[model samples]
Target: MRIVSFGFQTWGRKTLQALIDSEHEVVLAVTHPASAQSYKAIWADSVEELAKEHGIPVHLTERADAATIDLVKQAEPDVIVVNSWYTWMPPELYQLPPFGTLNLHDSLLPKFTGFSPVLWALISGAPEFGLTVHRMDEQLDTGDILVQRSLPIGPTATGTELVEAGMALIPGALHEALSVLEAGTANWRPQDKTARTYFHKRSDRDSRIDLSWSAVDLERFVRALSEPYPRAFSYYRGERIEILAAEVSTVRYGGTTGRVVVQEGGGAVVCGPDPIRGDNHGLVITRVRAADGTEHSGAEFFTRGGYLTDVPE
Candidate 1:
């Protein structure tokens, strides 16, 4: 099969490699124009580099411009495969290939159908998440599913961990779906409209912590936004403090919510709800990053006796 691949980040690399390994002729590779500031750079290796190595044409553009479309059309590709590119693709672009375009999404369709699906899955406390490869339609991620695979999200797994796990399955799923497409026996399942849900892009403000939330909720918040994100955070003395690691505790202190309850072992306990069977919980701080850009243990953050507080309007 003559394939045209549109992708960015590690997922794109993996999918392209899979197509190559599957004995398909990848004639053109398209990716986003590289930028230095955003973390997109981390996962981006020069697609041109890989294309050059494979003697394939490469297109790096901000959009599916006339030149890019011309390049793809010239490649005479039979199929178009989209992996992790962030831009909105127009219908005409997807319709160019004879076999049509297919997209591999990191989350199961009809549940999480937008950007940052893996991150939203972790924040939603879902124990399981999956990948889906579906035919591209005029709508985003609303295509019929050709292949799907689910994986468990361990209790301690971070957002990055879950994304990595989900990304790992894209290659195999893409290979299998392509085989079905080539054999002219592709079986697709329609997505349930009633089960569909979408999440907007998360902003820095979304990472802020609310002391009024239960401890378990706060703990989950901390885990979901850790590392790659700015970290779940709260205000203290008019300065932002990032919570890097935390635990939920049953012990309660008479102190007010967001007040420091204890400081020990380089970590500190913050006042939160006590645990209940069907109802309450408490949040504890195990690690943090001070506003001055200093990373500290929970105990270190507490030595000054500064307490977590609601952000002032």
Candidate 2:
């Protein structure tokens, strides 16, 4: 099969590599320009460079403009494969190929759609997360599913680990989908729109720890925002502090939600919800990064005892 690849960053690069290694030929590659966003920089692999190295024509565009459509028409690909390609693609573009466009999303369809799905799945205490290859349509991630690969969310899984796992699923999923498409035996399943849960793009503000949440929830939040993806953070005594590692406390404690009430195990216990009733388990922050960019054990940093507030005091 002749293929056109639309991708960005490491995800796009990986997809292009898989196509290059496959039986099909990649005729054209479309990708976005470099981004300065911290999230985009994390998995920074150059799809454009990879395509150019292989001598495949590359088009850099933020969206599917008139020139891009003309290029795809000239390539005359049998199918289009996409991953991490920002911006909307119109029907005239996606529906151009005989088999239509196959999009790779980082979460199971009918749930966790839209941006940063793996992180959102971890933070929401989901049992599992996976990759999905579906036919692109009018709505975002609402297309019929062609192939899916899922991984269990372990008790201590981090955002980085799950993302890598999902990326690894791309080769197998893409190959399988292509085979089925070639054989004309693809079993495309329609998504149950009722079960769909879409998430918005995350900003730095989304990482702020909400003290009202249970310690269990907060622990998951910390793990979800683990290394290479912006650590969960809060303010302490007019200074910002990033929580790098944390867990639910062994002992229960009650005070104001953000108060650094006591030292427990190897960290400091921050009181959680229901302080008046004094019945909530505290979040034990084990590791942290201070405002000055110095790392410290949570116990060592909260020695003076103060409140971790949402904003500078």
In terms of lDDT, which candidate is strongest? 2
- As a TM-score, model 2 comes out at 0.98
Q: Of the candidates shown, which would achieve the greatest TM-score relative to the real structure?
A: 2
Please give, for residues 61-110, the per-residue lDDT of candidate 1 as tens digits. 87888888889888998999998888878877899998899999989888
Minimum summed lDDT over a 10-residue window in model 2 is located at: 265-274
Per-candidate count of clashing residue pairs (backbone under 3 Å): 6, 0
Q: What lDDT tens digits, residue by residue, belong to model 2 across residues 1-313?
A: 9999999999999999999999999999999999887788889899999999999999999899999999999999999999998899999999999999999999988899999999999999999999999999999999999999999999999999999999999999999999999999999999999999999999999999998888899999999998788889999989999999998987777667788854674454555556777788788898989999999888788888888888999
True lDDT of residue 294, candidate 1:
91
Once fitted onto the true fold, the runs of candidate 1 whose alpha carbons sit more than 4 angstroms away are: 37-39, 253-255, 263-280, 310-313
Cα displacement (angstroms), candidate 1, residue 155, comes to: 0.7
Q: For each candidate, what TM-score against the reference?
A: 0.90, 0.98
Cα deviation of 218, candidate 1, in Å: 1.9
